[model samples]
Target chain A: MSLILKAFPLGFLINHDLSEEENVSRDLRFERENLCLIKIATNLRLEDVNYLMENLGIPYKYKNDNYFLNNGLCVHWESYQGHYSVFISANEKTLFEKTKRYVDLIKQGELLFKNFDIMLKRNTRDVNSKEIFYYCYKTNFRTRLDVLEALKKHQMENILSNTENEIRFKYNNKNYKFKRNNKKEMFYIELEQKISLVNIGSGKKSLIVKNLKTNYTNMDALLKTLTERGAFSVHSDKYNIYCEMSGMQFLFSRNNTRGQYFLSVDRVSDEELCTNILKELDEEYGLNIQDIVYKKIMERIKDKNMRIESEEVQDDNSIVLTIDLG
Target chain B: MGKLKIKLLPDGTIEMETKGIKGKKCLDYAKVLEQLADAKTEKISKTDEYYQNSYLELDESQHLSDN
Candidate 1:
């Protein structure tokens, strides 16, 4: 006689509802294959299997020489065996039935998920919970695009040259245009504000600036110091309108019977801020500031002294500094 | 004659062995298989025969006279 194994829901079994004919049929079939089937659930701990078997009154059996220890499920059985085989064969009909039950449970479990969703919604009502807004507010600084728009709106031109190498912005009032050579470098234009500045260059030496407009002579002395050390300007504007030397810029504006000046250096130090005002200037104003500064400083030194000697040496960090003595 | 052997484990790991080949020639022989499998060489062993073959000198006089 052919045995028809009625498959009952595992939920029905857990609930102790075995009164139906379907439950009786499923129970008989499950009992027959329980030992062999439990072996397939080895990843489920021994304690869990023992608890399940004891509760269901099923006996446990172990078999040696089973290759299933290394390779999981290597048994071949008939697909339509009214009862599930000793092996956990993922046949189409079995998978379809199991998947249907799983989907039903998942649908039923949506009530719990809905409660979780309500809790999350209630928690997010607090202002502190708005983390996304906080992050956005913290990072809402003016971008390059914003700066460019602002510069355009201000109508700052003439000194502003748009090129791939650098972006030049001329402060019309200050009579000096700031050039940003590299992306990380920032050149600021303070119309009437006095800013302290310090710059550490080649040998980690600092150039001190107290007041940018007032300390023009001190700034020139620093430039001369840099020139004597061989780090001179490769470019200079006609009439020394602006000095671009050694990757730095110095801007001088012609006034009535005099000249007002601004010093721009890449970066300044705390000590330099105490002594002088340093403005960072960029090269590429279509003038070789380094050569101009070098020649000007050399001439001044030669005029003061009988002989001048200069030598350049590259340090371990590969920075070349030329030293000049008068 | 030396032959190379390659075995694949259940977890997709591969073990390669060079059989009959002497000295570092085993490495040369297994290169193709290693390339095909994209295997990292975890360990390597040289047999006693590998060292013996290195010291074995050919009978040069016999070959010279024959030539």
Candidate 2:
């Protein structure tokens, strides 16, 4: 009965609304096996099974060590000495009816599909072997043929349409799925590749110095100071600029908040350069504070109509401003 | 006469000392300087002179007593 039932040519089951099939006979089945059959069973991998179970939200029932779909369509796996084969077996009557209707619709111009070159020939050695015409349905997926041609031109391999809005392809040893919404015309690609880690060995602590704050909130002022001190920018990007000072290379990165910049010494282990930069920056900030306070004091004195009796500079570079109250 | 001695340090610290301003008046100037510099005051030490009254205030009190 199984051998006779296997002779029937049935395509893979595609899930769709069966509102037009409300009047079809439900008890119809193959004469010999009394079970609806699917000949082109889809050979699936673990990820494909996951995509069916998780992404498509298809419910399955486990029975007799095999997973059965909504209507007794079994998805079973077989193992032989550590090698595993997984495939879907269709046994539902409704699904077989839909497949038959779909084939008829394609033939009658109500539906559309491209005729594949390879004819599905079941058992050529048997006297009852017949050539069955199988069609690759275009309704399941929609994409411009030019877009597929362009993808092929760019060396994208194994491009397959899995659903209405999804196209899975492989490029640069990475698998990705491109999905598009026909209504909104918006699309995005999801990466379906495994991440591999590269080991970066350590023990070169003095080579890379990171996150050294210059305490200047303004990046322009900081760069100006560095430029004035004979450091020239060698390379620059959006966030970081590499500079060289006195034959040593360093990086200035805007990795901090509020327009602040950080200095990272790259590949140079000279502690003196770091100390010198800190000293110069310190002096610059101190001078800036001194100027601001001096201006503020002078403005206050002018507003109060006070007289400056004496202005002196001490040996330690301290400024003394004597104000006389009138 | 009031003297403001400001030392700009190499470590980005500002040291300010107010002389001849007595009776907490120097604290006002300290606050003003800190605000103008946009810096936080790490330490403040008040000398004995900060507690002393100004010569003008002392003279005014003496003159009021004579009157």
Candidate 3:
């Protein structure tokens, strides 16, 4: 029998502590309150991520399935969703304090957490995308004719005469089409790529671009994507009418087979933008501006409500809320 | 029939507009929807509907009652 003398790699074993080392493969496990913890305003490397997680004295696992972070704050990283978001449960208000500490550490000397509510964009593509500004409003247009009349009254400039049956528009190299799905609801799809063009007045290269398409090619997939991405939908409807004018768009929707009248302005970025656009739209259509419906609907909906038409976060940049009065 | 319209914007703004109806009657039926959505009364436009005193809505000569 040959005896082999071997020195144990004690240092290697000590340094690679299984508990301390990040389980980059383990599916993260944590109860998400949908509350953001720390916003990584800038790009960071894996080492920096490790350093931050270690100093926080939290058990965090970031891998393929999920990113679970726990520092007595229930922190989790939302990286797979296009942007990197660190979400923490605001339970017992511990998230606020932890967020403050995180911001302080990241800033070191610069401004951080200026508006913690904003959730500033990072590479987190799923949420921070500025592409699709999906929004809806509660309108009282009884029929398609009523909507057309309002559009004309509001001076929707250069609208297509609709000599053709299919809804189509061409601006620059981009072509947008509206097609009815099996559910009979309209889906906006992009049919072309890019082409540079001269602005009629300035002769400058310009693209009259509007981001309207969701990640999916079909409406059903889009609904699924939205739900998985944590979008809240309120209600469902039977029929819908859509139109576009200049930088603005409209969707008149209904739940019943007969006249349903809800008006929504498409593509405005925020509440202030929506308000300002509403002002211009009101002036054109003889409207008296009152309140935003999302807040009201949110208030009316119980937290446990699971209606898909009620609300959806179109992206990190936009939240689309739908409330079917029917 | 006169149309009582409730305009709900994405930013959580709601506007009520009545067409072919004059006086406060334009807002009468709208109140029900307003309450259902839990919306607050922000800016009310008279649309010549408030000042005419007469309930009849004339097609010509639009008048603004308030900003």
* Highest lDDT model number: 2
Error of 2 at A239 (Å): 10
lDDT for each candidate structure: 0.32, 0.46, 0.34
* CAPRI quality band, candidate 3: incorrect
Q: Every model's DockQ, to 2 decimals?
A: 0.00, 0.25, 0.06
User: What's the TM-score of every candidate structure?
Assistant: 0.17, 0.36, 0.21
Local error of candidate 1 at A144, Å?
50
DockQ score for model 2: 0.25
Ranking of predictions according to DockQ: 2, 3, 1
Candidate with top TM-score is 2
Q: Candidate 3, residues A1-326: lDDT per residue as tens digits?
A: 01011211111111222223333222111101111222232233444444555554445444542334333334445453343444333223346455743212222111222222223232211222223211111122233333334334434344352522233444332343322233233222222322111111111112333332111112232233233333332233345445433223445455544332455654432334335544554342321211234454456545424232434444332344443322
Candidate 3, after superposition: displacement of residue A237 in Å? 33
When only chain A is evaluated, what TM-score does every model earn?
Answer: 0.17, 0.28, 0.19
Q: Candidate 1 regions off by >4 Å?
A: A1-326, B57-67
Instruction: DockQ winner between 1 and 3, please give it.
Output: 3
Q: Write the per-residue lDDT of candidate 2 for residues A119-185, one digit (tens) a residue.
A: 1111111111132212122221234353355456456689998566667677656555556667344
Choose the strongest candidate by DockQ: 2
Tell me each candidate's RMSD, in Å, in order.
38.8, 24.1, 28.9
Clashes of each: 31, 0, 29
